[model samples]
Target: MATFSSVGVGTGGLDSAALIKKMVDLEREPLAKLETQKAIVTTKISAFGQMKSLVSALSDAASKLTSVTGWNAVSTNSSDSKYVSATAVGGTLPTTFSVAVQSLAKAQSTASAALMPLGAAVGAGTVRLEVGRWSGTPESFTPGAGKAPVDIEVSASDKLSDIASKINGSGAGVTASILSDASGERLLLRSKVTGEEAGFRLSVMEGGDTDIGSAANTDASGLSRLVNGSTVTQSAADAKATVNGIAVSSGTNSFANTVSGVTFTAVQVTASPVEISVAKDTSAVSSNIDAFVSAYNAINQLINEATKFDTTTGKGALLQGDSTTIALQSALRSAVQSVTTGSSVFQRLADVGITQQRGGDLAVDKTKLAKAMNDNMEELKNMFRSTEGGSAEGIAVKIKATTTSLLSGDGFFKSKDNSLQLALKRNEADRVRGEARVDAFEKRLNARYSALDTQMSKLTALNAYVAQQVTTWNKSSG
Candidate 1:
């Protein structure tokens, strides 16, 4: 549990502890060198990990430029968003349309005539509910054709609250609630969905004596009284709109597929038409190019730093002179400089204002890029995402392929990482063996010193006793 700094006390007048330590230190010196080697390998591994991350980032940025949809994005502008707003997706052609909002869709609702107190009993009955649509001025309610009606049974002792609960739990397309006001208690019902097709009608069949459920005793009437025409509150209506003078109707405010790849949402009624236009989203393509340039520069910087030599310090970087790193840098530069042979006027990255500098980093000219995008958009697109393949392949595709190979399982980087890890393991094993040998040598030295100290102590005591005898004999003879 504890370790001693020295082995012996030197009681026999010899510094045996210091001698033992010197021997042990000499024997353990090789372990220290092995530790240094492990540290160097670990640093190399860390550097390689950083290299992989930078390359992966560049690959992700390049992938965005390989697909047509990535650059075919569109943007929408609505002159008046108060009444309607629109959005367009990729492949939506550039065009303009006029949108007019007439009316918003509404849900049907109804409230019963004033009944007795909240707890007052209503006669037992079977309430049947049907969902359908009603149209035309002074609307007429008709049960939906071919649709089954939901039937709910109530007991004679059921109170007004119990009736509402039963109707709510009947799985009908209507919701029921009890509303109490100065007039007393009433049942309020509303359709679960908006629009005319979601409208519903309720009819009741009383259970017992007609006296307790008669229309005359409206206060204690059966559920049938709730369906009277006078109780009708709000009527359902569909949303009406117009696009370029063409009438359009929807069951809800949100309309889709009415305009190709465009979704229109009606907010409120508008007196005048609002102009909606879809245009090519050139800004998005510019942003993608910017990202690619940024990522490419980052990888370039990392590779340069990892392989640079410092003349002042007379030392190179951690990965300096490494063949794998050198090869990767060369391949990336070659991929970028390679010409893309396509039908487009722009055949290379420089054609689009992306030029490589002397240090192997890319720079962008915003003005040139914008002009190219405007004048030769189709040709520019083909230069970056052509499907011809081979030597005519786009720069992005080429770079992506190169990075993918370098980071693969059996790739250069992976092989180097495997070798470094193996070296570290071997160094650790050597350290362990060296430490074991040092410990065994120290134990042997301690044991030998302990035996020598005992023998010298015995001899010193015996010499003192013989000297005392000789001195006494000399004194007596004098």
Candidate 2:
């Protein structure tokens, strides 16, 4: 009789489960290769996305330089900024002027006589508030037109704090507060706006039931003390100034449209006139040019690195053999190098101190650019933003248009990305099918091995029984 030990449920003593796994792995090798290829495509798509973003940034920078307003910005300077400050718009002709700030506008305020306590009750009354201008030595009051007076009613039981709250919530363009001194607490009121016309006059008439004072009393001891006559603390006044020695009056300190395309704001009164000058801001134009150059160079650098091939390492970038990236780089370079035919002095970017480097990046010559901007500003502006559209369009405009077309929905990069995404989907589907086949093969191998193991065990059992019976017969015969 012969006996066999179980080795992975196989009659031949082989590990069938391990062998089946090895076979399945061999069969799925192609699927693994597909996964690797999908990874490569995904990386290439990411590289293209980054390149598109750089190109878009460059386009935005170029678009800013395509307008005269973008380059012709101006700045105003005041010799004594403590007295006045000014701002100017683009294309404002350079000029110098003398300015003197005489006085700033003021708001009117009034306060009542000292009362006993903040919560003490005062006489009941209806106080009518009106916003108007005051003039003349005796101060003749005329109510403002188109502005209806606001009236607030007070009761005999209402405290000073309650009266203040009622006046504040009445929308009378006056704010009320309780002020305290060594004598006692008093109610103070102030106009919301500045200048003479913003002044407010209060007229109070006593109610039938009174608490602190007589109903007909018009003296300081009565509720009528909050009026403008004896309670006036500060008078309202308008701002006065002089520009180029000419007197100028304004209701407010901030003066817009004082000079053409200029705004002047008075800070403080000045004893002598301050010099305010508006000039052509060449530095601003230079800064814009530098920004454009930097943005263009950024895109150029990205394209260069993404498309380069290294012969020494036998390695290449993700976009090395990509036709779309090659075409994009060529188009961007051509747009930057194109010349404007209509411009007289400045026809190309090189004419205005922007020149291409050996590596396709743009370089700016600050001194040369400043000279060009000063000598031929109109021609310089036209070179970058020509209104006569077509092949004669400016370089900035051409570059902007090229980038816009490339980044559109059906653009080159988008189409390439879509194709890669489709390939990834196909790869995933193939992998899934391969995995299913492997699983089915593994199940079949396990079932066959288990049946064979049962048959081998039965044979061994029968052989052992037969050997025992033969031994017993041999002993009987002996």
Candidate 3:
């Protein structure tokens, strides 16, 4: 039988195939490791991006703290902050200064002359106002030419609330409403149709029209005005309600006469004091700064993870000593160091106890911070909120403008993240491209092994056939 070589013929041929196979097999581990590395890098990049966002939020919050006078976030546990003068706190008293009134634009009591007026007297029935033409006869109601009331049927599933929605949605020339008071809830209907004839007529079909009283129809058991106690009917749009001889407007009335020049709007009729106190919100400003500091710390913690070097693990930080991170750190440090000139407030980080330590880490001076918070509150507020001309308008506005320019799409954070993402992507792509080369190598190796198998099988068959033929020839010659 023909023998096969234990080792392939040439070192550069089958030997190279085995070497390539070994190399390909070895590549699987590193490729997997590279994939893991890519994941880690992606995670770091994403975390940094999140850190950027959080820092931006923190900075914004801080800016708000610095600029806004009364905008503060108090802890739920803090009792110094109070909701004192609001509704529930002083229920019987006029504690709240805020006022919101129902819109009266839809409260139409009169219309121009195009509508048909109801006749002298009527009683119990469903008042279905059918649109029609005017016939001089009081009972002869004819459909108006080129005019029709939209046909709308209110279902049992629909409540009084749904009626308004239905009429408004049906392209109808009317609106439905419910007028609520101490008496009860009354269904009110008005016309969306403008001008004199926009108002529709009402004719009861089921229940008695006892509640259908209007300025136009009062003789039919319905009152033009619901008389109750000393209450009076108002007809004009500009009418004001009086309170102990004080002229209070009906719609969102503001009184600048009270609270030492403080304008307060009357919301409801109450026997309470109409006084609201406005003071310098010092605690609020402090709490806001504290919250901003907390947020900044949270972001700082995340960034620290990426930049930290672990001495115990003997492993480098995920983004350890990254130039971009270093640059950002430096920029932050410099930005914090930059002082606002000609300000009466604590303009520099040192004034607020934020300083760099010997270990290159940030240190806080609690006492200094407290003092700065207390002593230079207004100054700090100005430093944060002061405009280019040192005028205090909106603190958040100025801070947002500055920070947005630093962290926006074309800003430092964006530019750095984008560059890092591209670098990571390129590294991952290169790694994947390198790993794909192994597939071709693996295929070539398999092909070589298959050719070797076929050649060995053919040689064995030829050797067996030759050996059999030789034995037969020897036997015949003997």
Best-fitting candidate, scored by TM-score: 2
Superior candidate under TM-score, 2 versus 3? 2
Q: Between candidates 1 and 2, which one is better according to lDDT?
A: 1
lDDT of each: 0.83, 0.80, 0.50
TM-score, prediction 3 = 0.57
Estimate, for each residue in 413-473, the C-alpha lDDT of model 3 and write its tens digit.
Answer: 7787787688788878878786677676676666666576568767767888999999999
- Model 1, position 348, has a per-residue lDDT of 81
Model 1 CA deviation exceeding 4 Å by range: 1-10, 13-15, 112-116, 119-132, 136-178, 183-193, 200-232, 409-417
The window of 10 residues in a row where model 3 has the poorest summed lDDT is 225-234
Candidate 2, residues 398-467: lDDT per residue as tens digits?
8878888888999877887899889888988988897787677666666666778788778878888999
Q: Tell me the lDDT of candidate 3.
A: 0.50
User: What is the clash count for each candidate, in the order shown?
Assistant: 0, 0, 19
lDDT of 2: 0.80
Residue 330's lDDT within candidate 2 is 91
**Model 1 TM:** 0.83
Q: Using lDDT, rank the candidates from best to worst.
A: 1, 2, 3
User: Could you tell me how far off, in angstroms, the CA of residue 137 lies in candidate 3 after the best superposition?
Assistant: 34
Alpha carbon lDDT at 291, candidate 2: 82
